[model samples]
Target: MIRPRRPERKAPPLLPPLKLYKAILRTHVHKLPIELRSLGDEYVKAEFKAHQNIDNPLHIVGFLTQWQDYLKNLDGGSWQEGKLSQEDLDKMSPEQVNQLYELMLETKRLGSEG
Candidate 1:
């Protein structure tokens, strides 16, 4: 007898748009410098508004994942002109410190050229 194929798994339901919107803005934009904060808020609002009618689970997940990563980079200061604070450096292991140093050098090199 031939074995039956397993059904494909479905993605979990997405958080409601307003809920996700509030969370992202609260977590990602509230603390930014005034001018930049407003700009970021507007961009996020526009993007979310544009995607409001998206019904595909895959696309919604991808959009949420992309914004979550953006929030993480903003919170971690990884994209804050690629600069790490002395306090943050002091908390890292020697290996991490070395990695951060290398990353900073690479960012600085690219920053100068671009």
Candidate 2:
């Protein structure tokens, strides 16, 4: 008996690795206006400064949510968004550097876990 052959099916691409995801999240946070990005991050840093053990993952997710809202609001404001160029990283304030580090660490942890 002759049987019909089926076409090969390929799986969808896997989501980006966690390192990339965290970097995106950190970048998103850094690019937000100080007013928009400050509250949650200040909370995280304050807790850290107090020597409290904070949930780093939750902090990252919370920041991600805030960043998304900022993106939504800046939906058409490219001019403001333009200021956060690659050049800006070198000039980032100490707090921004810390946030970036925290985000990258969380992302690396997520990537390793998966």
Candidate 3:
């Protein structure tokens, strides 16, 4: 017997990179606290700059997808309550994990200094 074919799921539309970057910086980042706004802006700028030359479609999609989720969370006022899921942590490379750890430490230090 032949198996029935299932329809492929479609991903929601994403903003183009420059548009998304501007949206994050111009709209979302302004809603953050002063210190956090500075940090968030710098981080977003650096990440976008770093990925500007990336040629892989999958990597670009994943990068944009994550940033888009962040934008959505900020818009919905749940960004502070966000936590990394185990599945997401499992997907990170060692370097990415280290970077996340460092960012955590920096945020903690900023919190302490405030």
- Of the candidates shown, which would achieve the greatest TM-score relative to the real structure? 3
Which lDDT values do the candidates have, in the order given?
0.70, 0.53, 0.87
Predicted structure 2: clash tally: 0
Tens-digit lDDT string for candidate 2 (42-111) = 5444533553344586755554454444444444456253434578688778888897778667646655
Top lDDT prediction, candidate number? 3
Task: Give one digit per residue, the lDDT tens place, for model 3 in 1-114.
Answer: 998999989877999999999889876546787767787888899899999999999999999999988888887789889999999899999989998998899888888888
Q: After superposing candidate 1, which stretches have Cα over 4 Å from the reference?
A: 1-16, 28-30, 82-114
Cα-based TM-score, every candidate: 0.51, 0.29, 0.86
Checking candidate 3 for backbone clashes, the offending pairs are: none
Candidate 3 deviant stretches above 4 angstroms: 1-11
Per-residue error (Å), model 2, residue 78: 14
Residue-level lDDT for 98 in candidate 1? 81
Worst 10 residues of 2 by lDDT: 12-21
lDDT of 2: 0.53
- Candidate order (lDDT): 3, 1, 2
lDDT of 3: 0.87
Between candidates 1 and 3, which one is better according to lDDT? 3
